[model samples]
Target: MKTKLLLLSAISALMFVSSCSSDDDTITPSIPELEALELSNCSSGIAEGETLILENRNNGVDYIINCTYPVNGDLIIDPGVTIQFGTDATIRVYNSGSIQALGTAQNKVVFTGEDKVPGSWKGLYIISSDVKNKIEYATIEYAGAVGDDGAILLWSDTHLKMNNTNITNSQTYGLHANTNNNELILENNTITACKAPMYLDASYVSAISNGSYTGNNTDAIIVDRGFIDEDHTWTKLNVPYHFPNGVDVVAGGNLTVMPGVIMKFGQDSRLFINEGASGPKPSIIAVGTAAEPIVFTSIDNVMSAWRGIYFDSPNALNEIGFATIENASNPDQEGAIETWYGTVLNVHDVTFKDIQNCAIHQYKFPADPDTLTRSNLTYINVANAFCQN
Candidate 1:
């Protein structure tokens, strides 16, 4: 019995020792607290297959992205997140990376600079990202240090959908589309306080609905390349089209202005139609009715605020019916309507008023008088009715 009791006690002791050793071998790793980390020691670039989630800490420290790095993974920023950037530090999204920053109206995700000044940091750059990147109910301000591409640069086949966002106080352009394949969708956004609010080719803009472009130094939309390939009609709903830099209808392009379309031009702005080379000749068919005529005027209502339209193709078809042109024809520039290279123009039921120069100026007159067709043309407050060069 004594040996039995001693053996039992030895077995119990061995079991207890083995249990303690097993517990020691299986240890729980310590997780460092985010509050304990110094801001200087924060990581700069986000690596592949890694996700960076920014939570709302009550602390006043602003998370800073130190350098320009391509985001290969995901960046999920929570609401009320304020991210300050280092000098020229841009968040570049490339190689199928995505950013899902869905903030509320009250708690918006802000992308600003460390100094909180205009043009302080480079803006968000989305390049060649096939994923669905979205930024909603956020505030992007004080950017535009990257280049002439504006504060929010969308480049190289990126699909960025922005809604209910406020982009203001940019140095050059508020939203600049550099590439032709950018599928940008803007809804209920307010873009203001920049040299130009939106700079894009008219072809790449997907949608512009319920947006306001006010307080801009230049025009509302600065179309870099105004080449309309197919037949385009500007209706009354898209009225008040402000063109600060003017538009050029390239060769093999056709633009048709419908009735009740108002075109407002800026200072020294003029519309040019290029001569065709091989394909069908470019044409501008601005047809308006007597009740609802197409109106072309200046933005500030200043006389001669813009130079008028110029046609350069002789073989191109040009027609202006029931149109009213006001505040055009500067004395130093050409007339309200000038045709070059023996291009013929037909003006019917058209009225040209407040003209600083001639209402119609034809350079190198055509062989036939019927080439410059006119019917019921009215000139009010005009300097010169017709001038031949």
Candidate 2:
């Protein structure tokens, strides 16, 4: 009996040891902390032959980039890096300098101001024409100081490939591309809480995919000044083009507005379609379907919020069909669709609503009324259907 009891006790102890080994195998390992790097005596700007690799800097000191001399080297920032800027501090990249801040999906680089308020620090300026500049998975906030270019300013003829970046809380424009040849490749970027999310010339935009502009104080996208020199089409996939300062179709430019596109104009803003000096006269072909019509309205949705669309000596190819012109037309001036210098406009199947003045106004009528094809014109709450001067 004693031998059998001892055998049972030995088997129980073996079972207990096996259970302990199995539990140890299933235990999760603790993750290691990120190593911090010290940036104590870093100066204002990064000069030539210097490379700045910003790691985890949780210190309270701010990095000021005065840019006394142009940058000519690489400023590489790793993932999970945070940079705080001093008052009116700006990092200007010039002389073919480049910045490669490639962050991962889980880790992101950040740039903010000392006060953590909008307009506290000057933003990043890329004045170099180098195409090697890139920023991905980063958060740039609380920028737009006085005399500074927007949060991310591109003054040179460079191409910036930005992906999964967030630019917010800017006192002025979120991303301002001033140069004509500055191309932007934007994808999955969220720009919000700024005066203007994007202040760019529409012609300079290379490509945009999954870009979000929301909660901006003023216009979402302000087209600063450039003629669309190519055959461009604004589709429904990119709707609600908020133009605070208005856009002009200069000579040799052609703009086609697709169906179901919403164009919001700011106060006193107008879409000026100017005549070409030599080449094919600039024209606007805004044709929409019955089910999906193009809408041109004021941003505030108030009466006479904008100056309306002005066709300054447009060509015969210009046409406005299946469109809705609303909240346009000053009570003291011309109407929503104005033709200047006897410019014959083709209007068909178009609706004019909430117009303060006439639905269509012309400086002078065509010799024959039929010269301006006005068919299926639906007018509602308009002071006058047609006004001729």
Candidate 3:
């Protein structure tokens, strides 16, 4: 520190002397500047221990990714470091590699395209399960160049933590988690101006929380076919979840949906609980509060656009309360809620609407079914309140 001060004092003295000699004699001090680093530099060890450390140069973009660059070692990005990706550029962190792009609210790391347009780059892909693979206080934009994955692709079994980030202007889905099972945490992130916000399997939809996925070109979360073979919870995200196909709660699986979750199903969609006769008796616990009821409806508002919830198991754990199930009962299928003989279920405080068939179609029933007389159930524009199949 003392040496720096002395050097500054000497420079000041020289400038003063130069001013006395000739006011126009201006000397620009020379400071060595670091060259821009490319993503290929990180493919091999740029530092000790096979780690690449990128610091903020307090200027323009510090790194350029021009190809499908592979990071073979650990990479650390400091706050306020900007990375400009060229056409078709992508960052692929291998299984042995990890990336930690830590930034602050005041100084966020930026990953953007040189062309300032969507689809200018291929985006980042994380295939590692390293604990250090985290991205926070960052802005990822102008990605989703390919028709495959989105701005960020998380492979199977990878652990990626992304929070407080902004992802915008993607050509396709903002983020894609093509994983069988991955610990991808998303919290307090905002995604907008993209074609679609996200694409992931049903099991990974619970990873999102308090995130803004609306105001995009397509304002819906596209979840893959809901074939959950394990215990999974469908969390209530701000944006509605659209299931283009059916949801099968097969054996060895239990599905639980949180309250206030708006689930939109396409045609021929059905929520089958314990459909197959193997393993344990699975259940669907879709219990919601009356104030914030869970909703299960077809994407189309017409009547009977899809098959409804079906329960084939005799599991006593099946319960559906304070929910709105509508637009169900196909031509060849049963009603909104179907239960065969000996299947145990607890259905109450629910509203059945726009059904082409009975609200609750049981295989055998003694009393005449009517939601008008029932205290716990409500019906609106329904064909039949309940009936024996």
TM-score, model 3 to reference: 0.85
| Tens digit per residue, CA lDDT, model 2, 186-224 | 788889888877877777543556678878886456666
Write candidate 3's Cα lDDT for 166-252 as tens digits.
999999889998567688888889999998899888877777888888889878888888567777887787888888786788887
**Candidate 2 overall Cα lDDT vs. reference?**
0.76
Q: CA lDDT of each candidate?
A: 0.74, 0.76, 0.84
Candidate 1's TM-score reads 0.68
Candidate maximizing TM-score = 3
Q: List the residue pairs that clash in candidate 1.
A: none
Global CA lDDT of candidate 3, please?
Answer: 0.84
Which numbered prediction scores highest in lDDT against the true structure?
Answer: 3
Per-model tally of clashing residue pairs: 0, 1, 0
Better of 1 and 3 by TM-score: 3
Model 1, position 324, has a per-residue lDDT of 96
Write down the RMSD of all candidates, one decimal each: 10.7, 5.9, 7.2
Query: What are the models' TM-scores?
Result: 0.68, 0.76, 0.85
